[model samples]
Target: MQIKPKFGVDQLLFGMKQTDVKSIYGNPNKQFKDEDQNVIYVYNQQKMRLTFYEDEDFRLGYIIASDPELTLFNNTILGRKATEVQKELEQHSFKTWEKEDFDLAENHFNEDHWLILQSEYDQIVKVEIGAIIKNQDEFDWKFGAK
Candidate 1:
């Protein structure tokens, strides 16, 4: 059996934070009232939603992704609450983050992790590895997957 090398979705959700959502997608596109009249931040797209809202305390609210791809990501991560994702992110070594989302190519990945930014023209990916670095290495970090 050949096990594909892909990052675990559970890991992605484990250490995520509300700030991570904001940093990734900026602000939500729409705001509206739920049945409770709480301010709902709706970053909605075709059949997709990355919503946020505040509780009575006014602290950072939950950031949720309501898309089918989220379900296919990893069963362990399915239906994960915002707080759950934040916890997972905390466990992994801190790596640089990207705002965009989409497919990543092999060149984008290092030995350990890669952050891919979804863009209109091209996808930007940032790679991070677990190793000691005495100095910077020169590699053409930007290239298409194809």
Candidate 2:
């Protein structure tokens, strides 16, 4: 899987409805409404969890993946040390992360870019991302355009 911040991942673009994704990935292993009332689809075999928008549109807004081959900026990201990943993001000029330190998990989020990395055992374990939605209807691609 690929992480294209402020855009889409692979063929799955933000603003795509659940049905749009179903056409590509087929039936999910599990599906449910999240606490925030957004629809969620989990594909266990693919190690992915997709979350849609909360409002009526139900566009694809967020993605969480644990796939070992997941790459960001052409670099394989998962399983690397957190510092290494941070450096890579910095190299891309993505600074200003909202970092949270905890006993088990260290979280970093660049809200402006809507990219998140979570680390356990000092190693990056998961990548979560969302498009910069504008007017609740479109993916703001300006960030990636830079």
Candidate 3:
């Protein structure tokens, strides 16, 4: 399947994309979900004490940094999609549940969440985007003349 590159605030603001991200970073050590449904992707830049998550519809979210709250565009700290749902495991003592409809901005924190909750149109289901970052360093750059 063909995967088109998606854009986000960090990517648009910093001009970083997936390819640029992977070239200079490592893999995330943790991945979790919040109360909403936005999948939280976490990447550990051990030396920098930073973590990232990729949260959005298919591909709207960007790489979010933890600690200082620095966002690195184009790098998905966690290798998960917002539409993905992690089955509640038995060890965590959390029951298996699906993501309900909700927004990331209005209903949740911008640092914690990305968008706002505006789906008042039905019983919505979404994955919770916990404190994570989505690193998108996987595509080739097409902008600017280098």
Candidate 4:
């Protein structure tokens, strides 16, 4: 999986309509509703979960990726040391944040790119990327363009 920061992930982009996504990936292998009642498309082969916000016309909004081959700025981040991940992201013009998200795991977030990494025992375990919606009417969005 290639993380495009606040921009998007791989070929899937923020503000993309559900129809577009379905056309590209076909129907999700599995579908479920989140607590907010938003629809999530799960791709088992990709080890990826894509979230489409209902209020945003079911456009792409969030992504949860567990692939260890996750890449960003040409760097494979997952399964790497936290220190190494931080350095890689920083070298690519990302801001750094190292903290714990609710005590579940250590978190490294890049506000500049809207990316979050969850780590256990100092190794990144998951990669989260979400978009920033500026205007729903225009579908103007970028992952971290706040």
Top candidate, metric lDDT: 2
Taken over the whole model, the C-alpha lDDT of each candidate is 0.32, 0.82, 0.30, 0.78
lDDT of 1 by residue, 35-58 (tens): 754455455651223222233322
Task: Tell me the TM-score of each prediction against the true structure.
Answer: 0.28, 0.87, 0.25, 0.85
Evaluated with TM-score, which candidate comes out highest? 2
Model 1 root-mean-square deviation: 17.1
Regions of candidate 1 where Cα sits further than 4 Å from its true position: 1-20, 46-55, 60-64, 76-146
Q: Clashing pairs in model 4? A: 6-143, 131-143
What is the overall TM-score of model 2 with all chains considered together?
0.87
Model 3 CA lDDT for position 4: 18
Candidate 4 per-residue lDDT, tens place, 1-146, comes to: 68887667777888777777788778889999899888999988778899998887677889899976778888887778877878766667876685666565888777656688888877888889888545544544753337
Candidate 4 TM-score over all chains jointly: 0.85
Which lDDT value does model 3 have at 7?
Answer: 29
Error of 3 at 53 (Å): 9.6
lDDT of 1: 0.32
After best superposition, candidate 1 residue 117: deviation in angstroms? 28
